[model samples]
Target: MADAAPRLLELAEHALSTPFPLRLRAWDGSEAGPSGAPVLVVRGRRALRRLMWRPGELGLARAWVAGDLDVDGDLYEALDLLSGLFWERGADGSGAGRAETLRDLAAMLRDPATYRLLRSGLALAGPGLPPPPPHEEARRRTGIAHTRRRDKAAVAHHYDVGNDFYELVLGPSMVYSCALWPEPGTTLEQAQYAKLDLVCRKLGLREGRRLLDVGCGWGSMVLHAAEHYGVQATGITLSVEQAAYARKRIADAGLADRIEIRVQDYRDVRDGPYDAISSIGMAEHVGSDRYLEYARTLHALLKPGGRLLNHQIGRRPVRDEQAYRIDEFIDRYVFPDGELAPIGATVSRLEEAGFEVRDVEALREHYARTLRAWVGNLEDRWDDAAAVTTEGRARVWRLYMAASAVSFERNRIGVNQVLAVRAEAGGGSGMPATRSAWLS
Candidate 1:
């Protein structure tokens, strides 16, 4: 089985033409590729078994998450390299040759368990084995999709991991959404601060104004508004860990009197007519079927002529549904039931909810930059992050963030800050005629 590893690569040489200079190391003293190349080590028989059983990106993800396979160098680059093999076309404008690909695949399936599974075309979830803990349980959702109970469960599943882990990834700012890079040299903290303040400015937040932040992560925006803008701020989140950490931070910052953090759902918030609302990075979780409900709820929460700055990730319009494969991996491993609607769809829904769309700004490049910065932070603090969360969870984040960055950069996905206003009875939005007031 070990000797066949090298032979398998040799068979799929066409796919490796422009691949990263990486070495493949098998567990049983067998190696492939250049001597000093970055190592992708198959640590045990399980890696091959997984590949043989599932035989595609899913199998690769499972093996990688289970630590059956590991990467020794630039994790982002290695992921990109592997992804290129499946997506990139050959000189003949087609993918890898069928016969060679099949031969290579067969070489990895020589083991008895893998062979049996391959022949049966069935996946076995065993008792003692427990299906490689992380990969097996990653996709388990708690309740029905988009229900109030299910949404809370999904939010908790993703965000309740640990506040310490989030702090490590998000830096001192503690903002989980996209950060606006003011310039090429700006740091992540700076970008996040800018993004938070930008939302404040867009909403025209002022002293004594009541601000509600839906899906606020760690109360970054809430604290910023309370401290800097002098607004009475309220932040809601499903993650109990986030609420606890945010409350502690608010107290420590001497803003407890002005800011509040609650482990509450958006639908449950009965507090009415806030001067402004900020829903950063939360809209994606409101499934398409419930998107209008989400929009309407926020619209109802705002006072007449009140502003809403909703920042969310959105998908680009695409003809090929297969291009959404990355979303499947994301749903399984990272965000359990998250959905990214297209920008147009999002705007239409908001409009349907009676919001006067004041501004629509696509921050695709900015989100890509933000994600890359996060990926870099996670990589730099790899050991520290692993201590906070499992190595498998960290790997899941690292891979998902890198892939999302690429998607944003390529316009496959996007992030937008949609500025809307609850119009008065006289059809007045009470917004500045031009965006110049908010731009500066």
Candidate 2:
């Protein structure tokens, strides 16, 4: 069966040459697969070879967990390619596809024997698998924290990684929020700038106007608004590290006079009566129960006829909890105390807070692209990143990339940019109709 390796390589070549065009390297003495492809196969030890041959999603996941399989190209692209093979045709009694794969995986998860076997394999193969950290540890540690302690822990655990690590992956803008991809072929940096501009345009920002950025990270959006749009911007963040970095960045940009970063809670943002407000990637911290309070706080902060743009992650309305293990995983490892409310819920709360919802754009696919870029960046700088953060952090980011790719691809999670207007008292006709009126 020496020819079996050749046959497998041939099959993989065929699959890769198809629409997927996967780049992978087989370390075995298999025929040096396709030529000029990004995928590479390096000769490795016997244990690595055995780990690579294992079938199904669990096997791939385990291989990743054990660091047995490493994709030199884009991890997201690799995931996209592997997603096609997640369910093999004729593997189950039914035909191969998503349905069959999920069915098989579900069955495996449910069966006691299968569960024990998988668990045992994981115990033996996986390295440094520790019990999940207590959820509220961060909140208990940081007194006067608004969000749940577990939630804060999750956010801190994820974001508190060194700033330089995020800088390498996120580029010069350091905008970790979703990008607004205006058109195909848009570079990640261009899309990010466009997203910031889009927010400024939507909010009717103008020179001499005061703008408040709630939960601002590293002052990217606010600084952009101040520099390019001619607005004075103030940013508030819960992260001390982020605030310090943002202050330095503002000073470096010569905008320390025009832009300020405050290490304060969103609830405590008082230097307002601002002309416009933006909360980019911040609403997730407000929790599902506190969304109303969040909306009300924005309403109180804005001046009459001012606009507010809330960019956030949203969950679709669904009763199916079984398919959402990723959410639980995110809560435990990534975000901890975070909760995603459905888009409808967010709109309802906004309306209840007496704001006029002007527009809601679901940038779900754009977020997929954004995350794909981030995962690609992570993979490209994995070694440097590993040096900057803890091993647990690396594992968490790996899982986050894989699960987030699935979530975005399947539309289980969404990114929404909601634009609302704070109606003038006594309610005359709302803000102007022309874009130039705002921009000029």
lDDT of each: 0.78, 0.69
RMSD of each: 5.4, 7.4
Q: After superposition, how far is residue 11 of candidate 2 from its true place, in Å?
A: 25
Compose the digit string of candidate 1's lDDT tens values, residues 1-440. Answer: 54744643443353233433568776766888877656788787666566555555666778877778888877656666555565432212233333224335455476564455344322212122314546333546665689888888778778888988988888999888899999999999999999998999999998999999999888899999998899999999998899999999999999999998988889999988899999999988888879999999999999999999999898755444333333446677778788887789899999999999999998999998999989988989999999988888888888788877877776667899999999998999977799997655
Q: What tens digits encode model 2's per-residue C-alpha lDDT throughout 355-392?
A: 98878888998888888788778778888877887554
What's each prediction's clash count? 0, 10
Highest lDDT scorer: 1
Which ten-residue region of model 2 has the weakest summed lDDT?
131-140
Which residues of candidate 1, in runs, are more than 4 Å off?
Answer: 10-23, 29-39, 85-136, 320-326
Model 2: residues >4 Å from true position, as ranges? Answer: 1-154, 320-326, 433-440
**Which pairs of residues clash in candidate 1, taking residues 3 or more apart in a chain or in different chains?**
none
Q: TM-scores for all candidates?
A: 0.84, 0.71
